[model samples]
Target: MLEELYRQVQCPVLAQLEIGVTPCALVFLDAEASGSPNLRCGDAFSYVAQAVTLNRSLLNAGLPQLTIATNAIDLVDDYLSRLDAEIRPAVFPLRPSLDLAKETRFYGAHFKLDLLEQMALTLPANRLLLLLDTDVIAQHGLDPDLLRRCHASGVGAFDISDQEFSAYGSTRVIDDLELVAGRPLRNPRWFGGECLIVSAEFVGQLVPVARACFGRYRAVIPDLNHQGDEAFISAALNILSERGQAIIDIGAYRMVGRHWSGSTHRDLRWFRGCALLHLPGCKALLGRQANRRTFSSARLWRRLVLKHELNRLVWSLRLHVQSRRRDKAIADSPEAPSQTW
Candidate 1:
């Protein structure tokens, strides 16, 4: 299944670069090192949730062999130990040479985002990469055929709600975004990387662009509670899309399958192909105990959109209204005040 996804997602890059390699998913975990007191930031409970979800989500998706690079190696090991044999992940100490840890400056959240960009660079430039946030986990299993939309060549990003130009606290993010794209950033769907899929071919070029954007962001935003890496990533995607790269919006490809959840509610919704879940701003979840939770005890709140016409009509209307409201917010947004952490 992974090989199929690999072939589908990397095909475009391969055609361009004319390079080939074995097909396999190189899964990675990027999170704040809460176990290291010096690097810790945000609620420890949230990190706990991220780790716990990573383990269970991978297990549920039947994906194992996760490679981790973190300051909190021991803590990650503890969580992986809980997973059964086939699903247990392996931990790797972060390479010092790749140590882009910027905890000294950005808040823990920023540091994690920086780390995520770094991890994208460190993956071997010969295989497929599945870079997931600690907060995102598998809501259900994966079927490669069902993931066809996500499998198309180049870079694929999750569709997220809170991704407009105003999404970032630092106004610089928006400015940098426009600068990168060489035009006003315009997109109805905000590009999200929480569960990002990248072909090795683009990573080499992607890192520098992301790093430049990150540097510009850090130079401007002088505080903790700023938006994470998604904005910078959006900048990269905008650039790539302009360059004729196959940057697939996973949500649109899957049509009604994969949905983005920016709400913090415990309620879960599943579309036909909805596989992974991103827990972004749930007040009940974040800034608190990310304490490792049990996946076994949890049950799917909803699954496979009902085939009824009434239900489908209602869902379609709700989505249209939500999209309109979001677009209006971004379009009507006033000039943002500059921010300092």
Candidate 2:
């Protein structure tokens, strides 16, 4: 199954810009596969704007940047060009496999995992790769020694062990995944997909396991609510760790998820000290920040925490009303399923 998946998903990189003088590099993924669901927060320009904001933040932090884009090469290239050539991210244009387009559940999130697998195979093994989401921003520069230490240890990712962020994982999800993998997880903790730091060698080892798990997950899709890459990748890491592989929880020191939406409102006091902030549910703020010549984090916070919540309330209410109307319409339809059980 793994070999077949590799053959189907693997494709040649059309072109790549070279990164200079950095053993560690950062790559942000913002791509939509051909014939795949368009699940970006906003239209094409919005998310690309977010990535532009993130790229500038990374360059400010002294990290060389790269972008792995599929199907939207011209758009990403234009945005990255806004940066000066010396620090602009090297854009690698990849063609997404048809298998990636078939996924309806995740809307091409898993496709990036396949893209990362290819990156692991193509890029130099000695250099470390930081796979960042477009929604995240770097708060501070990382020390050269710290980057070396993380790369030496193993894969770096955010650990969401606290029960507060139940959206990331649960006992039920782990139990189901363990049944699929046919192994019990020793450290059953959830890792967010927002920011992942990995070496090419480790990714080479991890992708096969994740691919196998995903292949098996197809049989139980109806039984599972969460089928994204985060769950499967977390399971794969746990399985590898049980086999003596090192998996570092960089959430403690490197990055933190700022949950300023939904029921999870994390304290912002700790965010100031973190090196990176994964600002999910705040794409509008990100786009606004990108247009500015200078950004103020304080204003970003006020708009995100206060104004965003009000906007979310209105958004949720509208969704609820739309859902209720849809339910009524379904009930009225002749083809609606009989409610009798």
Candidate 3:
């Protein structure tokens, strides 16, 4: 079923890109689950194909030569058969020593490890490597100047929602970042795991740390699951920053969207000229009803007004009901005191 969908979805995208075999790679880890009513293997395959299609289009438009790296076991070749001949897939085998018994809440850690390992092995010694998540679908073609800016930035990272940590029970992850970065880690207004760019030198530095951290934690915390790759990354930056390393140098252009709280801040006026806009969570935001979409504003006045009105209405209703209940309870009392008392 997905084969048909892949052909329908991917072929057109390839045609749209008009790309001859390029040097860029689009990497994805396998979907973890076996099967479900809402999402089957076929569905996963189709979704990945759609993502690749969008990525390929972006690459062809001007990003860079693309290559895809993923775990060998997870990526099915048959699904990729229809892609353009220029597109190549590099598969990395799962590490033999990785203990499967060590449970992790951080599913993204697996993908991050796979990406870092592949980058360490296959990435050119001094070229740029863009690491985009499988779920990210590029809506616009990247300009070459933007690619240059990312390369020049030394390291590029995106933000995720602060709310996700509590939702995922990952306060410990925040502590880890603070320890590594040294200073208190400021929670970005917007947080998510959508995209990252790594220079060859940065990859060399980060791969070892990521492996060590994953290995150590997997052994001790058998049940720590979380989804913030950026958190782990932020921790790494903290470590480098303490050592006086130029941890993350934002490039000439900011490569994320204005909708993100981190990007929306008035303090982020510096990023006004950024080239890439990480549009994580925009799809769901776009899907919401108009009333719900009003919450996307970063303005304090707007939010306070909306919140105040809502709270007033709810509290007024609650107080009225509570007063009536109290009066009735007194009337029902057998030896009621005087009303004034």
The candidate that wins on TM-score is: 2
lDDT of 3 by residue, 51-157 (tens): 44434434444555444554444454655564554542333444422343312343423455456555556655445566654433333354444445445545555
Superposing all C-alpha atoms, what RMSD in Å does each candidate have to the true structure?
9.8, 11.6, 14.8
lDDT of all the models against the reference?
A: 0.49, 0.63, 0.45
For model 2, residues 1-341, the per-residue Cα lDDT tens digits are 97745644562121121222121222324444222122354355566667667776777766566464555677667776775565455666666552533444555556666666766666564466677766777767764444554567657778875642454346776776575565787667667777777777788788888877767666666676566667677777778878888777777775555555543344455666677787766767786777776656566667666765676677678768978998999999999988876
* TM-score of model number 2: 0.71
Q: Highest lDDT, which number?
A: 2
Quality of model 2 by C-alpha lDDT: 0.63
Candidate 1 has which clashing residue pairs, if any? 45-288, 45-289, 45-290, 46-290, 48-290, 49-290, 50-134, 222-341, 223-341, 264-282
lDDT, candidate 3, equals: 0.45
Which model is ahead, 2 or 3, in terms of lDDT? 2
Between the candidate structures 2 and 3, which one is better when assessed by TM-score?
2
Worst lDDT window (10 residues) for model 1? 18-27
Please tell me which model should have the higher TM-score, number 1 or number 3: 1
Error of 1 at 336 (Å): 18
Query: Which runs of model 3 end up more than 4 angstroms from their true locations?
Result: 1-42, 73-75, 83-109, 139-153, 159-173, 176-192, 219-228, 249-252, 258-341
